[model samples]
Target: MSTNPGRVKKDEGFLGKLGGTLARKKRSKEVSDLHEEGKNAINAPLLPSSAELLPEDLLLEENAERSMLDPTSREDPKFKDLQKVLIDWINNELEEDRIIVKDLEEDLYDGQVLQKLFEKLSGRKLNVAEVTQSEIGQKQKLQTVLEAVNELLRPQGWTIEWGVDSIHSKNLVAIVYLLVALAMHYMAPIRLPEHVSVHVVVVKKKEGILQTAQVTKELTTTTEMMMGRFERDAFDTLLDHAPDKLNVVKTSLITFVNKHLNKLNLEVTELESQFADGVYLVLLMGLLEDYFVPLYNFYLTPESFEQKVHNVAFAFELMQDGGLKKPKARPEDVVNLNLKSTLRVLYNLFTNYKSAD
Candidate 1:
């Protein structure tokens, strides 16, 4: 492997042709020395042994020197301060990221230590919050709220029914209130829950082929029978009779039409829009449970049934006038009797009527 061609050169003549032999050896030696000098200048300390060396010895020498890539053991003192950075960089890129090392085994042989040890360490704090949610918790919450309402109404002989509802959208929790209406008395503007958007409307129903009072003449009847009471002429108009655009503030009602009506599977159409329909339904349900049911619970006395219906609807109106801003301070004194008026209407619609479509 000697590139020191002059030292290895022999003074020999081919077939004893001394002049020609000596001249060729001298030329070869000059070329070898020039190539060796250039290679050493190109990569001084970093250069591997010249390739002309014997293969076995050449590789052995390379291994004998600490590799520049091995920062921890390589004897470049400048590398001493950069071991942590080198380890981190290798972990991110070259080492396939086995960096989550949390061993405190206190049983490592020196040869088993993979990365260099840390000398200085600093503390760090992580910010994390814990959260928990469960179906059991949600069901329990619904049950607890229902139970309290039921218990409050128990003395008045009012029965309460509750269950989960299938929802196309979770925001339409209003469907939950509708499903719980076995607790209410009348069924016109089905009550709503709180904290949802809603529309309270003033709608008119006919009675006995005559124009009549919505409250007085519409009593003791389901919605189907009441609609049937209208004259054919009135029915024709009724189909088109959008309720007067009342200034409904706090009260909310969902249009029971097509995709807007179904709490599940609502679809949007270019011809019509379901504006706040899901949110409206939830809001109405909240209003029902929060305001209507409590009022109905208080007035379960026989005579109070009719008045409660009229008053609750009126209260819904008053909400627009900004009167019913809050629930009555004493809820017990204000609730009215349940005459099965609302439930009776609901049964008629749910069980007996043809599809509203």
Candidate 2:
């Protein structure tokens, strides 16, 4: 029986013969080692065909076991002392908040919370006669910074889109907000005084390695586009409340990327930017998100409060530079542990718990 005409024979060339010989040798060497090592193999012990691992053997409760063995558990005196210090710090913070709240209650009828905040911030008390004078001084100081920012952006023709309804009214709230805008502008890790272009790269996790999936030049433009006509309104709202707009933007951006990542097989390592303004904006936002607490009850819902605590805890784990430390797992573990410790304090604040007593 002859083979079909379409059947192809193996290469009979010298190079092909040599390649085939080398491949065969490699396979034989591998099998020989496996056979030789089989009796005393560096492998798990042989198991019965239907065997299942015991719960203890699987080490699922390893953390509980380790904590029991630990000498520095919460029951230790050192931790108890630390807890006291934490409570004291929280009390101090709450005391400040209470003062602010009392002041806001007085100022709300007049819509003067911003003036009161600025007064408190400046550490000078203003009587009725001096309040306007103090506000003028505050605006002037803020104006100096705003002018500097504007001059910096003027050459580039990239003026910030001030929310027309929100900013144009020139109310005390608006002026204070402008000051915040300037502060955030300056707080940005990158100075925006010079014209700069920005680029963003989207990365994906693939086989335990980060791989670039997409690159967009002008990431701010893309984000602004995503924000659309509501950009200014959204920014105004951030300035209006305790939640840092910059933080919200960044978290929302990263979350957006991660959410859409489905089957794209990507874990976010970090979002990176070359633009000084963009980088600085991110840092400024993170700072505010972690630290800024609204004095009044308007912005103090439980969900928002919890989010602020979460953001702050997350920020504490970061290095001065925006990049996450590597190897990534260690920093993440540390952050998680710290977050748990922080949550206890946050819970106390939430429930108005004053002390162990």
Quote the RMSD, in angstroms, for model 1: 31.9
**Who wins the lDDT comparison?**
2
**Model 2 agreement with the true structure over 62-113: per-residue lDDT tens digits:** 2221001112232445333433432343233335555333321123223244
lDDT of each: 0.29, 0.34
TM accuracy, model 1: 0.16
For each predicted model, how many residue pairs clash, with residues at least 3 apart or on different chains?
24, 3
Model 2 TM-score relative to the real fold: 0.20
Q: Tell me each candidate's TM-score.
A: 0.16, 0.20
Deviation (Å) of 8 in candidate 1: 89
Error of model 2, residue 193, in angstroms: 26
